[model samples]
Target: MEKIILASSSPRRKEILNRFNLNPLIVEAKIEEKKSYNESPEQVAMALAFEKALWVCNKFNNEEVVIGADTIVVLGNRILGKPKDEEDAFRILSLLNNKEHSVITGISIIRANTNIKIIDYESTLVRFRHLSEEQIKRYINTKEPMDKAGAYGIQGYGEVLVEKIDGCYSNVVGLPLGRLDYLLNKFFNIKIL
Candidate 1:
């Protein structure tokens, strides 16, 4: 099996990969998450992920399979990024209250030694419940949403604020394990289980 390398600093992504008992080398891809003018959210997500993976691969041996991912919360065409402060978190949560939004995640894999590269995106529809002001304030106090997109972490206290989800839950959490498993086997012929 080729060495697996994850190009991200997200502990959530690492935890997701750990579920398969795969201990990949974690490499931080320090790239600016800037979007092209009028770029669709999915496109931006995929591009960011590709940039991260490619950045790491340029330094490591081709025998290492470098994987990178980026996740974003989109409402209509507007992108909701990590909050700058608790007040910003409250504002983001307020905007998402009682509405449906999309969580898009881009995944990229590169193995120059094997001449393999993949870039793709997955989206999940998440609906936030009608949250009272008190509820939002309380959730923010937990400090989970400060670093998460859309001012919420579906895997944390934010779950109570979610009314429903229309797609892969893992995507909202940061990584889509099912699609990743498929890609791993299809591209690298590696199995997680």
Candidate 2:
């Protein structure tokens, strides 16, 4: 099996890969995450993911596979990232109180010492139930919303706010395992476990 490197520091992504019994070498990518003014959410995500993968691949000379991913929450045209502070989290949650948002995760895989690069994105629609001020405040007090996109994490306390989801559950969390597995098998000829 080719050595696998994960170019991200997200615990959620690491956990997901671990679930498949694969322990990848963790190498974080150092890239400026600035969204282009005219770029769509999907484009930004893919670009970031690609940048991360490319960065890590350049740093290693061994024949290995590098994976990178970026995720964002979008409500219409606006994109929401990790909140900067408690106030920001509260404001973001207020806006998403009773609305549906889309979570897009872009994944990139590259082969070290080669030009082989594969990039794709998965989108999941998440609908939040109407939340009262107290409910939002209580959740925010837990500090779980600060590190998550759109000020919420579907796999944690924020699950209570989700009314329905219209796509892959894992995509909303961070990575899409099914799509990732397929890509790995097709491109790298490697199977999970």
Candidate 3:
């Protein structure tokens, strides 16, 4: 197996890869995640993922395979990012209550030694159950929503907030395993299984 480097600090992302037995080196990419108004949600996600992967790959001899990813929550044209504060978390959760939104994750893989790089994105439709103010407040107190893109983590206590999910569950957690496996196999001749 090739040496894999994960260019993210997210534990959920690392955990997902670990489940596939791809024990990757954790190399957190120290790039500012900027949201672009001109680009579509997909473009923004892919661009951030590419930026992170390229940042880490530049430090290596290019022989290592680096993976970077970004997840975003979108309600119509609005992109709901991580909450700035507890109040912000409340507002975000309130907006998403009883509404269906989209979770899009962008993934980028780079193997500069082989001159191989690929960027792709996955979208999952998530419907939030009708949440009472007390429920949102209680969930906010857990602080899980502060660092997550959607003010809720489907893998944690936030799972109760979800009424239905129409797509990849892993994508909502921060990475898209199926898409990542496909990209690895098709582009870099790598197979997790």
Q: In model 1, where do residues sit more than 4 Å from their true spots? A: none
TM-score of each: 0.96, 0.97, 0.98
Give per-residue CA lDDT, model 1, range 1-193, as digits (tens): 5688999999999998888878888999988888785899999999999999999888786578899999999998999999999999999999999999999999999995567899889999999999999999999999999888788899988899999999999999999888788888898887877
Off by over 4 Å in 2: none
Poorly placed runs, candidate 3 (over 4 Å): none
State the weakest 10-residue window (summed lDDT) of model 3. Answer: 110-119
lDDT comparing candidate 1 with the true structure: 0.90
RMSD in Å for all candidates:
1.1, 0.9, 0.9
For residues 4-38, could you state the per-residue lDDT of candidate 2 as single tens digits? 99999989999999888789989999999888869
Question: Which residue window of length 10 is worst by lDDT in model 2?
Answer: 16-25
Order of candidates by lDDT, top first? 3, 2, 1
Best by lDDT: 3
Which pairs of residues have clashing backbones in candidate 3? Answer: none
Clashes of 3: 0
